[model samples]
Target chain A: MNDYHNRRGFLKKSAITTLASLVGTKIMFAENIPARVTPLPLLSDSVDGKDPEMTVLSDRPMNMEAPAHLLDDPVTPINKMFIRNNGLPPVKESIDRSAWTLTIDGESVKQKRTYTISELKQRFKPHTYQLVLECGGNGRSGYYPPASGNQWSQGAVHCAAWTGIRLKDILADVGLKDNAVYIGYYGKDIHLSRDAKKVVISRGVPIKKALEDETLIAWAVNGDDIPLFHGAPLRLVIGGWPASVSGKWLHTISVRNIVHDGPKMGGSSYRVPVIPVQPGEKVEETEENFRIIESMPVKSLITHPKSGAVLSSNRSLSVRGHAWAGDLEVTEVNVSIDYGCTWQKANLSAPKNRLAWQQWSAKIDFPQNGYYEIWVKATDSKGVSQPMVMPQWNPKGYLNNACHRIAVKVVV
Target chain B: MNVRRVTLAVAAFFVIAMGITCVSDLRNDQTTTDTTATTSLVDTLNYDPHSGLVVDTTLGLVVANCSGCHSTELIRKSRFTRDGWIAKIRWMQKEQNLWDLGKNEKSILDYLEKYYSPSSLDARAQMRREPLDDIQWYDYQ
Candidate 1:
């Protein structure tokens, strides 16, 4: 045991020395301090049959994310989709597909209307679109001086074919009053405390976004009825915006005359800086300094040659990834093999759906690489490209679209 | 200056090596007894099987009150000041169906503040990457 400790200590010291020499810094060691507190076992591990690859940030009010490498599919599988919930999910026993009702009301509605799940399917034309739904804090772990929410290291996003009625069609049929400005949504999921007054989550988008052709009151994902965790029977799927705006276990839609200030919509909850701030600088959460995040920026992820992957030196490597822009189409994707010193265009596949992510792949010859990094950058139809570094610092760490970097080693 | 620094570093390393040896000898003598006591203490805590939440006697009340509705993970994940925890509790009582703690509120606040206080700015900054040193140029043959 003593020898084991000595050997481990010597190895750690040697590693520090090498790192210090490479970075040209004097490394100091602290005694008795554990290098890191043991991270808790993922909550998914305890579940009967959950995806083992997911990083579980919390168990109750369950939040788990699939690692970026596991999310390489063009359409994210239902079982692999990330889960983010503000409150406890409704019990399985309480779910009654036939009895589910969606109530539409508010001062802005000329006449309050309620529709059952069956009625919604019978009354409206069903449209299907492949849409992306991403959490506002998708890449929050990359933020310096880490933010307060789940430290999602990307992969808090998924694109799936949604089968539902257009939200605009519902708004038109219900007859929106002239005063209606914002569309608020409510869900059946309750707070863990069973507090009668506390709402788990209630959020919405502006009337214009609510009326978009792509916005939907979805009943199905990936050609199947939405799973319970992803919101079963019925849920709102507002593409292009943060998934929070697309309330799950959806039951109510309220047309308000003012911007909805429901839970998770107030203060700087889902808001980002209006103008870029210095990295790691603190800024007060004020209305003028920040705005409610909308329309995500163009982003790409390198799925192949995942960070720390080993490749053969002699073989030509085929790098592949996925790219998407919120609401807008991704026009170009470029890969950098030499730390952005030079860029090579990658072939982008046509998206299967209007709002779906496009797959891109490129082949490159490694020039006897010791260590190599592949960077992927994407641009939207609006000509907005992802920044090389994080855009700005925000209190809650929302809307991070920094270019993705993947490190790989080539072995002879 | 470089030579002097190297010599000092070597001397300091030897001193640390000697110190560790002395400590290791003492630790080995007590290892068996210490391991048993630690195992018993850990067992007594009766950590939540699902969430791995440590619920010692000091925090047993919190586990009992909070875990009935939500997993202990929610409470463990949150880091807040005394006021922040109070505000959250009040918010839960007002909005969510959390019942008033009544007299136990102060104890809850004290426990939460002790265990889950907001990390200081310096502590957070220490987690940031140090600025990269200037690159030394090398000639490739």
Candidate 2:
């Protein structure tokens, strides 16, 4: 009799759970949440890790849904254009123009020096590049096992015409000391807690790379003084590298003989698995030493007809999106209309300079409808193409370059 | 006399708040979970009365097991099975640095085992309503 009762009770609960699962847990949460309160502010985009000063792709980076954000015109307006930032946004809106300072120290032959934002602009003619700044953990939220860092959704990235003085000019002034192994930098962010430790908050570039003319200490985005969330006053624009290494809200830069180390540096924070593992499966460091995090890998996404978009019959759909590769230049972009089975080359819009995402387009003949999947693959000039799957997964989400796929629905 | 009393109360409140805010970030109690080869760095230590960082029990078992070397993002976004979870967990623990389980570990694993218990079901049930559906979707798939 007791067993019969237990079984009956179990059946009732099972029936209820099945119903809930059908409706979607994510949907249910949305229904219950009040209209006024914001829901998850998920990090919005995936970034190429190479250029630290670069930005997130997708026409609209306001939120994290992929399939590439589309723009009717070639140029994404400055306001509607995507925005991405690493770490926390600066707390101050108008940091005291007088109080802010830039310090250059470390392995330089000359002693350390500090300068204000005004002095930086005054001393050097500001150079401009329509560059993109992306986070190392741009799509980090997509990491398996859900690392405990910022529960960033996708929008933690953006692109703009960053304008500033040449980084080489500044380094040349002090004269690069011969033993310098890395160039390290820090920002104005002081955690609310004095004793709280930070994970790999600092990043470095090989001294040899610092000599390039493309690098700069940028103060403007587009034509405007960078807004606070975009790192106001001054930020580093490391051409062809990951945004992590390109410091944001930069204040201090040091040339050092040793590899930078801290919670954020030389730790398990940015490791890739020794071997490829199943999705969500952990990857361990094998016999070999861990590899250092560096430049962005090749990746691309379809922007127009945002995934699941309803299309007009044979409307001459102009498929457009953006593609990026770290350090290396994007040689070609391939778009697949029949999903991953086939591919076609896309015409890259103007060369917006290699440091920024070059817009690409393919005109596809929209035919009779069923659910259609669009796939885009990018190949760097170096021949590295975005893979359909990442090699493996790691704890602190690092580089992810799986080809982005979008599903489209058709209606008569 | 009433004004004086009010002033004292306000001043005391400020002092207490300032004190708490100053010391709140210093609590790095290191508790390492070997399964994910994860040391309880900042998040575990930076406990806030209001932080929404608690691990979902069933999910936590899966994550704690997987995060040995990698992170929990893989689990959260997976569109997996009882065998999938188990197979992946074994790979993580054996091949990766995922922790070897303890007696308490089974509780979480059981929960995940029972939940992710195989079936091509995506658990996107609408338990709660959209907060801003009225304002319109925020954009993205």
Candidate 3:
């Protein structure tokens, strides 16, 4: 009698489970039904050895950004550095490092000059400095109405020690003319389409920024040869400016009397609004309305006790993160535990160089077990602090330096 | 006798389910044909994983013409109006060394406008709903 009852109970539960599964499947199918469900390839699935945590915006042009929690170190590792490519990387097999040459010429150049990788090492004094290279669209996803570009989050910036010869030293050897107003760089990466133009990305800076001691024509990163994806044979390393100014696979340096009109220089590509505009407001793209985005704004990120983390209420938690400002020092970092109700100063560390990011940390005790939010705001030496909310929106979504907020739960 | 009746009933149910699935599939195919068949070159093609673009009617032209220089992601990520798409093609031709598309330009524009129009209401709403609040904040310790 007991066996009969048990069998009946098992059959009843199985029937209910089957019915539930069928209903669930129907709902899922209905929701996914589209006019034409065309299958598009998933880029992240095709790539190998990529950090599974990193977000892959696109695979072909190979634009990927590291996860914020993974970017906790003061010095980002080579693999962790975000990859932002405008075009396909050159064929690795065809790269002849020994034969590689960089030419220096333009209207403002007194005479044309060329230097091989080995010659550059032998002739010029090598210098090393830890600097931060950040994408101009680091926080593009925060923009309202969305911008037209790779929607990057906070991990589009990385700090690393680069070893290279000073760019000014090379320019001095080439003899810059008095009229040299702008400097432009060109690379070997070609357009993917055969009929398309030869140049991929060619950008430059003013003569003054070009001559800065921190500017380098880098051959190595973090004491090792730069990886092929990061620009193998050689690349430029202009500190404190948008990374676009520092061309990769660099081959040519042109000293021009006027601003260089490269592939990415025009058409509101890297330019931002000249003045603050309302968020999500549509504006016309004109030279008078927008200007080239140069130095980045002051920014900070909270790395520790990650958002949505669970912690013990009885214990004091230490918070830590990195802070940086382009062409300026991070003078202070303040942490607020009670949703900005009270702020405590975090201890800031000195940067290794002028353009490197400073590390900041603070320890706080949770009053009671519940939900808590920690906010971090960084101030530059110029007294500019990161805004509490996202700053004015621009066409390209550049320079979003809002204070970092982390929400955590404390339990008994 | 009872077993035979149960088997027949199951078979009938499967047949009806398959008929419904086939009808829905045909409906989807017809919708695509109606929209994309304005050009003569619309052919059923397999998905190509390398370019991340569908291998349908106008896709072959796009892959043949565009993917040779850059990844298809550049095209896929952008959403523009019909005029905006035309303007981009013109800009590419004038400045970026893109060759003339000739007669294929019309078909290409049609395909892009149909498949990749400016963010639809549903897609825009979905993107807007993606929570920025959950983004992991990083700091130094």
Candidate 4:
């Protein structure tokens, strides 16, 4: 009798569990989350190796721009340099220095040649130059009709000392054909899709720009191995142009007879409208209507005392900053405390090298205690000066070299 | 045999009564299984608090389509017109290999235009700082 009761109880519980499970499964599985969720910002120090102050724009293909104040150092430290990655950096284990090699080949090469990093180092003389690299969209936030991409503020520029062999030396060794018009570079960075065939980004400069003495196939910055975030094993450092022209994780460079038609070379990638358009005007862009941006415009940043600095009326305020013109030198930098009513010239210093940024300083005394804005404008070797307002609007919002202003409060 | 049959019938009735009681206990945690019920489960159930995306009917579709390539922060920080959004979509499709939205394009565009389009706060007249007449200066040693 007991055995019969036990069997009957077991059957009843099993039936109930089955009914409950059917109801519960519907509730639990109702939300369908896709497999490829957005990447979370999960950079531990070891992974990114960037200062905590750097603002991250993207994580998957990590891009971070430095803050204006932290960039006060005359020579930008490796930690403070901005990182712009177009694709996933080669895996740490795969970046074996011994196995790394750079190949020079394309339609315009007399003969294709490959060189190991050690061989290149031994064969060619090493040179160092402090070059200023500014992103084309450095002041993009100033645009009224917002631009797309990494909404960089004023910190995408850095002047760092890079030690490497001159790219011109390598081109000379490779014996470029007379027809070589442009040189496009290839990197080892993996595409986001992990597709082996697709290139993330491959941009190049004209052969004339490539042959400049300052253009370097750099392996180190500030006397140290290039930070992994800034493309350590090897990179091309073409200063004074858009930093993108300086490809990172560089593995191969191709000399092309025609303008190199790489992934980002065509379209309006780095090109501005040949005829300037009004803000918010849409144009059907074509080759004739747009031109590739070469030298970036004049720009300045006030890095001393920082914005929101508090000052005493009795003491004279000392201000300092760094300024750069794309391919020209900063001839003058003026600071205005009382709006643009009057301008006071600051003491300016020459660049350490040809394409390096110049430093400027000034001392000012306040008559009364209140809030004031210190605006700094830089003029390049050419008569061109930074505009007080946003410059001509472009579709991609490149080169918004408006005067940088900082707020200060004075106490009596 | 007759006695055994009688016992089986009585046991079956008792077991059915117990099963109904067990089902009632299981239902205490759930409000209702009906999906169409008017009570908004969006705040409590359907929302992702991390991205702070406006929870609407089309949010799941947006996340599935857009978040796969970039963080929702990129979407959140950007303000654009309907045309601008369309241009970006076209650019991505052309350059970044974004798959065609197909039949779902209208809904996605509608959601983006409603939430992501630029507003009057963008006017430079409003964003400019007020002239520094009113002053309360802090004492700095």
Best-fitting candidate, scored by TM-score: 4
Cα-based TM-score, every candidate: 0.76, 0.63, 0.75, 0.81
Model 1 per-residue lDDT tens digits across residues A1-412:
1111121122244444454564356544423212111112212333333454565666677888876777888888886788998887787678898999999998899999999999999999999988889899998866665466776767898988899999889889999888988988989897877765677889999998898888999999989988888887789998778989989999999999998978888767898777777664556777788788888889998887546566653546788989999889999999987877899999998888777889999997777857677789999998899887765678787888888877666775
Report the C-alpha lDDT of model 2 over B3-89, residue by residue, as the tens digit.
012223444454345434533434443221111101111123222111112233344444445444333333323324455556566
> Against the true two-chain complex, what DockQ does each candidate achieve?
0.12, 0.03, 0.10, 0.07
Candidate that scores best on lDDT: 4
Q: What tens-digit string does per-residue lDDT give for candidate 2 at A139-253?
A: 5544444443343433344456778898878877767777878788887653322223532167768777766666778887667776665566677778556566667678888
Between candidates 2 and 4, the one scoring higher on DockQ is 4
TM-score values for chain B across all models: 0.51, 0.37, 0.54, 0.55
lDDT of 1 by residue, B1-141 (tens): 000122234444543454344322121211110010122221222233233443334466786666677665566555667877786787667666678888888888877765455432223344332221111112111
Instruction: In angstroms, give how far residue A375 of model 4 lies from its true place.
Output: 0.5
Q: Compared with the true structure, what per-residue lDDT tens digits does model 3 show for residues A45-82?
A: 33334443456565567788876766788888776788
C-alpha lDDT of candidate 1 relative to the true structure: 0.70
Candidate 3 CAPRI level: incorrect
By TM-score, the better pick of 1 and 4 is: 4
Among all windows of ten consecutive residues in candidate 4 chain A, which has the lowest summed lDDT? Answer: A1-10
Which whole-number lDDT from 0 to 100 does residue A196 have in model 4? 83
lDDT of 4 by residue, A1-412 (tens): 0111111111123333443453343222211111111111123334444554566665655767776788999999877888777778888788888889999999998899999999999989999999999988887766767777677878998999999999999999999888999999999888876778889889989999999999999999999887776776899999999998998888999999988888878778788899989876776778888888899999899998667667764656888999999989999999999888999999999999999999999997776888788899999998899988778888888988989887788765
Query: Where does candidate 4 stray beyond 4 Å?
Result: A1-47, A313-315, B1-47, B125-141
Question: For model 2 chain A, where is the 10-residue window of minimal lDDT?
Answer: A1-10
For all candidates in order, the CA lDDT equals: 0.70, 0.52, 0.71, 0.73
